[model samples]
Target: MASRFVDTHRDISYTKDVVRLHSHAFYELLYCCSGNLQYLLGVDRYQLRRGDVVIIPPGISHRPLFLEQLAEPYERYVLWFSQEFLDQVQVFCSDLDFRGGYRLLRTAGTPWESLGNLFAQGCREAERGAPGWQGHVCGNTMQLLVELHRACGKGEMPAPMVEQHELLDDLVQYVEVHLAEKITLEDTARRFLVSQSTISQTFRQKMGISFYRFVTQRRLIAAKTEILAGRQLETLYETVGFSDYSTFYRAFRREYGISPSQYRKLQQTQTIPPEA
Candidate 1:
């Protein structure tokens, strides 16, 4: 059986656009090495600084928003852990709680140093893949989480940098609740008592994406989640707001580089191994 519990990588000069606002079936821990970006966690937005850490739980929609041109390439260490891996760590560290929505740790002084060291060590182990590397990475991850839980207990977490925009937040939440219906920008603008241009500019200026594109991305993410849950691909297009299977198929292929059926088969063949 595979002994790997976490997938880890470091991006030195990452400048790719994460167009899809999607969720995962596992945990995501991101340590910002150097970057200037705002992160959208659900409806909340955060301005990330160097040494900031963001922890996202499974099934929560998230993506980074690049409102302006980056003066420097974004650098960060990203770690992905299976739910089973975290569950095992939780068993021994019962005081650490993992049943939360998301956490943004803005650290300084000793806590920042410790977390950065852990992230670097984990990345190295993952890269080398030496003998017993899996165990080493697992230990490092547990320690990192434990440290984070302690930091939270000590009140090191900070509030989101950007104040919540009531209209935009409500509109995003509205889209999430009514995602199954045939949603249109005109209808959304009318419901929110705003002009179509207002809605369009809000999405473009604030979210770095168009309103229609945001809705479509959300729907595609929902469809992807349902497919992972073993839903019938043929029955999902309409349910997820796509007019037909062909449209859904084309969008899915365009966004994810594979057909829905192909994605399902790929997932099935590479299911993460359970904890021993």
Candidate 2:
């Protein structure tokens, strides 16, 4: 398997207006530098305070909720790496649950300093752009995982609990069935006979994402599948419930790092493997 790494430091101000529930094919480690942030995983919301580190695995839907418009910048360090990186480290530690789902960690003592230094070093190596920097970053990333596991052993942080609710399941199914239609939080709340706050609270508490984000993400996923299946991009925006092409274009690019047309071309050129 191949390995890759990408790291960035963002001093973000203003709110992320759209609720874009998205995921990647790789793991993400988010280290909050400062400010209060709400981290959404699935439908559950975790209040991320400064120095909090969240470990998110591949295929797990999540997003950072910048609900309130900030007076000052909200700083964070985000690192993404391929699954192979975690696999290589797993051979040495059998108890670590790197691939299970996601982890919310708070550093303690030695592991705290260790994880911080490793992340800082990884960022530096990434910025330096020297020869063999990839190797250096990978090594540090592995260590960061190890330090994270060590902290877990010491009970530095408690694992976030995920509870099941029957209403949430129905809500998800309802959204999926009505993907092509215009829906709002107020409408959903009214249909379910719950208040807007109840809908938002339950979604954030159980699914780790906002109701709005979940709907948009589902629509985008449908849009991508239709695009890859040879559907015309110009016709998809309206069908996907996006009112305008520009808004759809921006959201699509933000989620996939490419325009719908570019994504279509890339998918078309790739060789699909035979099924077993």
Candidate 3:
């Protein structure tokens, strides 16, 4: 395995349509500088505020839920590190919980500003690429992790949960269960005993997208995940709810800017075999 693999960057504005629910093969840490959004982490949702930090482990699906347009540009700092790098860090601090599922740290009364500064410093180091910048970025990351551990130890501030609309939550779960099947808004409405208009309006108001669009995004995400896992692309569309090859090919390329075969080859080249 490589000695270290880390990437850091800051996003100033929001792209509501392009931001789809997805998972990574590495750990992700996000600090909300400013945002009006709900975050979908696994099965739970969180209403994010300034100074809030979110940590997610590999293979856990997540995305920002844009319920409404932001008055200000949604700003955030994101850091991604491979598990190999985290394993090295854990040698010094084994008590830290990086694999205990997703964490939402509310920075109320905590040294959140300092934590945010660490994120900024890491981003700068990554972007400048000066001599010894990797070590500096790693050091900042370690200190940030240690500070977060200490903050969790305080146990004074608890993570606040978002009050999700029960119907919307059920709708999402239903879609997940039926992702491989042909799902329609009318079918969902009839199943839930509500009018089709209600279902359409609910998804538009709560998810910031039409019901069909959300389903398409989810299916495409699933197909991408399977591709990364080394699945054959020939019949992958049917398994992910795409009716035919051409439809899947067009949608996948449109959403990801590359063909599925191209994406598979790119990932294969970038992948590093684990040390024996």
Candidate 4:
């Protein structure tokens, strides 16, 4: 979260017992107002209860993996922004890792957590003051830098932790761009003129998962994001490479902790739908 490069405050949505969604492009911060929920982050999945928060970073595909039966994917607020907005703040966080990721940084005083709360609180405070709504969001965004400084500590930022610099990022970026088309490792590796083993090995080395798994997770996430965005089920499913209806449904549920149809229905009644 202390990187000095370009990033965006990607999303800050309030869930009202509706569909819990995740995306591939940006980092996500889930601040639970109440209830319990499980999230699939990267290859390792985890859960969070009340007052619990989680961070999902770029390149790592994540989605809701579980939720309490009584909570209807509601009562949660999210602040999703890029880690790059803190170019100045990066200078202060010498102890943080520069390469960037969704590391579980102590949850409370960590750079991710503090900035998350600051952003979420700012978003809420902005709604209280109507005249400067836009400015309030903007100002709060700027304040996110200071929050990072406090959470990351004055220690020397850790070295970039990313292992594979090429394949993993390339593959994830490919998935994001080709979410609407059928994608396969053979075709993907062919585009890069590398062997399947190379693709698989490189992907696992950096992402800690197989290329195929990453692709499936990415596609399911794309379909989920599209559903949250109000796209038709069949259309989005096919667009993201699900060839069969039943398979799509099962895979979506396995990854998201809920059915696609249910998510779409909940989104319709909620506030602004999800955006990737």
Each candidate structure's TM-score, on Cα atoms with residue i matched to residue i, is: 0.84, 0.63, 0.82, 0.44
Worst 10 residues of 3 by lDDT: 267-276
Model 3: residues with Cα > 4 Å off, grouped in runs = 1-4, 14-18, 91-100, 111-113, 149-156, 244-246, 271-276
C-alpha lDDT (0 to 100) for residue 205 of candidate 1: 77
Cα error of candidate 1 at position 218, Å: 0.7
**What is the RMSD of candidate 1?**
3.9
- What ranking emerges by TM-score with the best candidate at the front? 1, 3, 2, 4
Better of 1 and 2 by TM-score: 1
Evaluate all candidate structures by whole-model CA lDDT and list the values in order: 0.78, 0.68, 0.79, 0.55
- What is the C-alpha lDDT profile of model 2 across 1-276, one tens digit per residue? 123444433335455443356655556787776766566665466777667788877556666666554444567676776655667777887676677668787653334744666777888887897999888888787778778887877875655444344677678777867878999998999999989998888777655578887788777866866676677888888887888888888988876677888766654544111100
Each prediction's number of clashing residue pairs? 0, 8, 0, 17
Candidate 4 residues 29-54, lDDT tens each?
Answer: 56655544444455444445444445
Q: Which pairs clash in model 3?
A: none
Off by over 4 Å in 1: 1-4, 13-19, 95-97, 109-113, 271-276
Instruction: Name the top lDDT candidate.
Output: 3
Prediction 3 global C-alpha lDDT:
0.79
Give the least accurate 10-residue stretch of model 4, judged by summed lDDT.
Answer: 1-10
